[model samples]
Target chain A: MMCENQPGALIKMDLGSLTQTAHDPIHLLPCEIQYDGHAAVDKYFTPTICQGVSAKEVSFRGRPLKGQEIKIPAGYIGLVVEENHRPCSEEEGRTVCMKSTFLSFTQWNLETLPSADDCAMMSLMWPKISEAIHRPVDSEE
Target chain B: MELEKFERNNWGSCRLSSLVPPLCRNQHCCLGIDEAGRGPVLGPMVYGICFCPLSNKQDLEELKVADSKTLSEAERERLFEKLDSLKEYLGWALQILSPNVISTSMQQRVKYNLNALSHDTAIALIQYALDSGVQLREVFVDTVGPAEKYQEKLKQRFPELEITVKPKADSLFPIVSAASICAKVARDRAVKSWKFLEDLGDVNLDYGSGYPNDPKTKEWLARNLDPVFGYPQFVRFSWSTAQTIVDSRAVPVRWDDCDGDEKSSSKGSQSMLSFFARKKDDTKHQPHRFFQERKLETVKDL
Candidate 1:
């Protein structure tokens, strides 16, 4: 699938400073939802978060969901993209449009607060590690 | 009915009450408090209060109010209906603690246990009566914990009222029995008509009794277990019965505050030298535990 070449218009090269205005915060839920479709998340899943001793508490569809704010690593940003139409052919890549940008998102877990030891949190360390590995080696060391 | 409002916001607690009977407001009244669905692994726990003028004690007894535990579902329903008919002589209220609220409160970081939740609900119901101008002179409660301590607590909260907290107060006092019937009937209807907010298509409602030991409830819990999300919100997730099922059947989840033995052992065994062993010649050097715990590693190749 990667060998096939397909092209689509880029609406904008950079959505500069989209995070200037306050907007709905994005969440990374722990569970897998089977459907891949747009949902009325604001209307349906309105989260009422409360402060706990060490974490935040919320409920999703009557189930307890614990969460913690996960800030994006320094020098990193998150982008949300949307595609209204599906590609008609395998060779035609789907057109993607920039929706919003965020510097951080809440990581939610089922009944427990996620820690740095979680896989998703750990993966965020890759960029710094990669840069350190590829840096030029000093000859005078 | 107020139950509709509760169903709409099923994640929170809801209170339902009848208008304060004029007789109760005019004369000194006796109030009884009881709860239902306390032991169930599914559905809500309901705290109910029934109050009537002390002069109408015989009328309450005439309604054949007895221990709700000894009565069948049909008998409880009949008694509740009979109690409802005498609205002019009696006033009642219920506080329905939803399963979601119960689970979340119990599982909070500071850990609010079920007994505390029950006591708070009962206290709230009693306070609601007093606020609504019910001239309650006496209060009887079916205790969940040590009777003397619970009675002392209630007395401390409402010193003006003569409070009686005893085990099996439902069987001993007709007013408490009436409260038990209201609680049991409300709990039964709530559990029976519970609507799943999730889109679990074509799921059946055959979970029997909601008790942890009931075979039918056990079967339903096992059958409906979601490997990723655990059971749906219908379950009381804080219950050991439910937690046992999740721990054994669902994916293992680790929390930050949990001092699990596995986490302690991994941290305890690490040596100070392992932190400084970053040498160019050592191709076999092990990564730090921070990476190992999260299963992160340097990919040598794409």
Candidate 2:
């Protein structure tokens, strides 16, 4: 795909196929609702309108995102964390999902996601699958 | 707990214990014990045992057991596999002591020295085989340590079985040689597939034989010396070679010998005015052989 700067205010872009198979089934789209320069973010997911478009050669405007948010989110944090070490709003202060985090999936969530009682009887046998990859070499101490 | 269903706990760490297969009844049974990786600076030192009915002596002899050092690795492995398949007639066991355990046992902090550790492991394997109901009348061991003391220890453990803890017994006894091959094969596989948990970055790890004299092992140690953490755990840190490399690479930590005891006694308070005053205990001595009062004997132009 190629990105070309066109005359006036339009940018011409080409989208092509990315891979042979194993395409991502999920895509997130951004929507903006504005009052002057202030924009209200509506917590809503959009249904796919263009189903057959190949998601290759997407033109990124301005700078690409620094993918920090994926690793550590900026959402609600636990109270157990120390104040100095806890993830804080150092940049723009409205607490957005701790950049990439914020989703509630705690040890407490284990009670709901797949509770111990809800798991199959074979759940305890998981270790049989996790054999040691490398046994230590002999040491003549 | 999720761990309750598992038959054993240490499916994860190195196996330094015995695993004796059940022996078939009938045919006078005897056993041979030998070790591999004893002097190597890498991998677990393995003690292997081949116990079979007296009838299978010819079968073990047919395997053409010799000092594992003489056999090629592929040859040793082939023989090991054949011995493994004959479990119905022959029962074998191994005590795989991981490098960590070996290092731990030999390190400065632990005083259970290598000979004792090796002896204990060998004895444990024999005991395990005996407990597994294998009728073992005689046992032959290939040992580097003093055989008399080793034989005594084994005899004390199993008073009925005839025990011969002879150096180079692997050369004399075909069964012991077979055990030696088993040990050597296990050691080879272990060293070949040793995994480092840490991301070693670009360090090449094709160390040859894991022996101290191997230049490749030395090179790998030199290449992988982490400035702060030293070598990876696969290295026997207690081995002098590894210890020397790690110590040389490390920041020399010369800790002063601690002389103070735990007691903290308070001294009696002294008068603050004592600081300015001369002590009564001060004694003065006359200067001997001094050129006092500026008196000088001048010798002119002699």
Candidate 3:
């Protein structure tokens, strides 16, 4: 299940909507949510979503290209996935700006996240609400 | 939308403002565009555009829409009221770029300069008017950059229209003046009415014209300057005026920018990118749906 509490935050999510049904109960997974508040300002599309915008004007420096030439600037490999996966439709090719909808219930929900490099995750969790934030995106949307 | 913390205050949120003038049928209309608060580093910079029938140019002229920079605040407000009363003859729109958006764009390593942002916004408005069935023939624009280059760029974007990008087009052309008034008035109102979501009611403060050199604005910034978190949302942290103040107060941290440049050749330390890249490769079994390309959009709330 996914929890989409904020709009316009740059987030990594499954390409299509992450809901099995419209009424899927979306409660946080019962573990400390790893990534929170990773909003739009947190990152930007490295090459930018403007690449290959106009399908009609698809061309190399001078010569024409076969299929639309999508140049994905080395995607943002940050806390949130801000990369445009290459060779996708115009709409889907760009990194989707969203609040990460799901907790990595498998990897992050483990006993603890690695703190070897003094990661930002160290002080992120407020000991108080550490109990209730892992719910799924609203309606599992 | 940059400052997630100030979600309550518009100081962080950017918005587009539009007032669709009465649609002029068949008769070709001339459009005017101009920007306000381009220099000031405190508040939102607004790009305004207005269009009307060639015949109505006389009416707009009579309204005495002049260069907003030269007009008094009260005078600008009054003229806008008159422009409003003649709504059938005026069609206007505005895009307000907030300080946060301005700062973030400038602050980013791959900078999106203000000129480029303004150009795109103006193009969007012109495109909007054309799409909405308005017949435009000429476009008069006031520019801060080289007029010829600006004109060329706008011409490329909109070839059919007669585009004039000149310095002080607002003063030379009545319609451009109208656009200037619209943009300036909108910004004045936006700044005056801007609300802060964070409750700092105890500290009574007033931000004068957001120009960096303004005594009142400087005083306000000086009073509210924070050592660590930076100033409130209205300040453009990217601007030197704000940057100098913030940097002056910050306790600098030293770093070797080239640390772990060649991780493979180095004995132990790993580059930030290489370290993270190795981790991503470990998750090979993620479901297909989870690997789909994600789409992100910056949205504005009313």
* CA RMSD of each candidate after superposition: 9.4, 25.6, 18.2
DockQ in order: 0.12, 0.01, 0.03
lDDT tens readout by residue for model 3, B80-148? 777766766677777777776677666543567888888888898889789867789989999867899
For candidate 1, lDDT tens digit of each residue in B83-104?
A: 9878888989999898988887
Model 2 Cα lDDT, one tens digit per residue, B1-302: 01121112111223332334444445568889998888888776778888887777888787787989898988887887787777677767767776655664554222668888888888888887767778889899987578898888889989999888888899888889978887788777766766544445455878777889999888877886654445555677778888888666743322112112222222235558877898775685433332222222232211
Locate the minimum summed-lDDT window of 10 residues in model 1 chain B.
B293-302
Model 3 / residue A105 / CA error / Å: 14
Cα TM-score per model: 0.69, 0.55, 0.57
Model 1: lDDT equals 0.80
lDDT of 2 by residue, A1-141 (tens): 111232232221111211222211222111111112211111111110111122111101100111101111233221111111322432211211111212222111110122333222123223332233244556972
Q: Residue B248 of candidate 1: its Cα lDDT?
A: 86
Supply the global lDDT for candidate 3: 0.60
- Could you tell which candidate, 1 or 2, scores higher by lDDT? 1
Q: Where is model 1 chain A poorest over a 10-residue stretch in terms of lDDT?
A: A1-10
Ranking by DockQ: 1, 3, 2
Tell me, by DockQ, which candidate is best. Answer: 1
Which number leads on lDDT? 1
Ranking by lDDT: 1, 3, 2
Residue-wise C-alpha lDDT for candidate 3, range A11-79, written one tens digit per residue: 345545334323211221112222333312111111111122332211110111112221112322122
Q: Candidate 1 falls in which docking quality class?
A: incorrect
Report the CAPRI category for model 2: incorrect
